[model samples]
Target: MSRKTLNLDSTLYDYLISQSLRETPIQSRLREETAALGGPAGMQVSPEQGQFLAFLASLIGAKRVVEVGTFTGYSALSVALALPADGRITCCDVSADWTAIAQRYWEQAGVAGKIELRLAPALETLDALVSEEGVDKVDMAFIDADKERYDGYYEACLTLVRPGGLIAIDNVLWGGAVADPANKSADTEAIRALNAKLKEDRRVDLSLLPIGDGLTLCRKR
Candidate 1:
């Protein structure tokens, strides 16, 4: 009872990628570096996802973008590289270890100046930002942090994003487990509940794409 498109083998996935345009050299190198790092090679966003995010950022003309997770900087760099010359992105992550790698790649991408890396619990940072007046000014927000706190992040983002802005939450499908009633794992349950909540929430217009672990996009109304 899960999403079928989510189940593609390595060979088929590679074939699908081969059919599409390839990433630039710098992006390819970044992928290689992420692969070498190992433990969470999958943490890096897919090339298609990166390109899509970049286009989305540019389309919104986002000046003050916020990313809840900055694993090895791939997503941050993707957004930063697309931002306007005067644009800036705030990246939140708690691990110095993972972000250290992201820092190097951001420098290599020449986008380090456009990104501000904050090392702290994402929820705390989000709450603090919301607490500051004149700071409820985010044009876009990307949430990909702790599964258990997904709703909390969504609420915080609802307050943080501009009326017409977007909140892109990653892993909403949780590898299709959200649709599988039999899979009762904690992460799966969290995503399932969050999906149901968003589906009924009239505050935003929602679209759940079967892309990279399933990306749920919500635009503020």
Candidate 2:
């Protein structure tokens, strides 16, 4: 199998959360609100991942971030809360219904001022940033949208972010389906191909963490 990660059964996973997970009122409320919507609420990242994103952004002193997906605003809230008051994050999403919910929570969280939502195809928005905002202006990017476009989103983020800036891509593992050859769906294939490409692409240092459906962190070199 070549994989060395310990299998996380429910008991072990619960223990891990009990030992380390920290949930703020705002975060908890947003999560509950998202959950109340049900259906695709599973798409909301785990609280641990949200905290990790904030910690990573703060650790690197990120001032500007581009978020490629803004479902209910949890991830954006995570990174936005960590940023300096003057910091900014541009969010790209196609769902006005979902983003409207996100906006309400962001306002309640008081980070609304720092987050800017652009309702368009993420590709178009990302490319516009490269042309209008200039290369190396963004400090970080988090991609969690359509799986088929991960490569294009990554390339645009690579251009927008400063050298050494981070581009975090979610769902690379696709619920462990990426490793299963039996799963050849369009999304799965796209993620698998991108993972293989990243293995040999020397433009950045990479770490594929087994968190919240496998997040791949690529730091541009």
Candidate 3:
């Protein structure tokens, strides 16, 4: 195992969040609940990212949203809260252990009825959604699961989201690995490859933001 940590420089990270995030009571409660779970605190989405996600969902008038990584439901909750009264989110993850925490928080946030949690491989779930008639009607999607499958998720999301919709991909920078040529782990290479692929993909308009790791926003053209 490598001893190195992939974290933002403290000052810069704090500055970024401070400038972009506006914390609410729900976010505080979610953080406390995540801490209680103990093992997957990092799974929680950043406050700034959560607010940004809400903004994105509203911008697209997203009635149907999809998330590739539920991870205790923080991000799902963020998006769900922003959704219209009848809006819904399909959350996919392979972890029953972590999703249990997600379920609890969803109930606490009163967004449980808005979320459908699926315990299965994210790619499989995504592909199945694409094949299922009437289910490919997603307005927005967020991909934040295993880095190695980032490309697969991107392709699946591209098909799932409607034309002109948004797909927000998390962790594309891999904590700066995509910028360093020396680092060549499977995850790093996968992100680099996906980045290149997105640059050339004609189906979408893409802009990479250096936010919380890095987020690539793709709007289906």
Candidate 4:
């Protein structure tokens, strides 16, 4: 038996997806469309990661959610699909071009009515949420925006979610750069700082899984 996470080569990865992934046709179509965009398509979460987000939302019986990044809305769609009919998710992003693609798929998915897209700087949207919704009202939050401001987003989400609420942060490993001392680029440094901070922060129970680019699951205490 393995003592730690097994490294997934392309073969193993494909096998894993073949065995476990349950992507819907719409989801698959969206993924294909996003992939056609080339490099930027990498910003979208893997199918497994999207499924995990949906699982988390369902686990908590989440009624209200917030998303700090809404790239093509795959993650949002995943979570939206899991929410009850009355549930709502506020999505924050700045790219009209990208989110427009998201809107079409969301409409097709029939979850468009549940999502509120705020096209502005994420920080602004998050701050406004804190003012309007107050502390501990959100059930879950997913953060995947600008790496440099991750800490700020984390703090805001921490306040937005109640005790036992969840905040899922994407790219904590920053494509494995956080572990390499030589990669001191601005984005890498920011992610590294947040990783270190999250490890010690007693306000939340944390787990950094070896998922897509590393996903940090933080349950607020």
lDDT of 2 at 102: 89
The candidate that wins on lDDT is: 4
- The candidate 3 region of ten consecutive residues with least summed lDDT is 1-10
User: On TM-score, who's better, 2 or 4?
Assistant: 4
Candidate 2, residues 9-73, lDDT tens digits: the string is: 99999998899877678888999999999898988888889989998899999999999988999
Instruction: Return the lDDT, model 3, position 201.
Output: 91
Best-to-worst ranking by lDDT: 4, 2, 3, 1
User: Where's the lowest-lDDT run of ten residues in candidate 1?
Assistant: 1-10
Superposed model 2: Cα runs more than 4 Å off: 1-3
Q: Write the per-residue lDDT of candidate 1 for residues 56-121, one digit (tens) a residue.
A: 888988998989988887888888888988888888899999999889888888888999999999
Estimate TM-scores for all models: 0.91, 0.96, 0.89, 0.99
Clashing pairs in 2: none
lDDT, residue 84, model 2? 97
User: With candidate 1 superimposed using the best TM-score fit, by how many Å does residue 23's alpha carbon deviate from the native?
Assistant: 2.9
- lDDT for position 195 in model 3: 95
What is candidate 3's local distance difference test score?
0.86
Whole-model alpha-carbon lDDT for candidate 4: 0.95
lDDT of 4 by residue, 171-197 (tens): 988888888999989999999999999
RMSD of each: 2.9, 2.0, 5.2, 0.7
Q: Against the hidden true structure, what lDDT does model 1 obtain?
A: 0.86
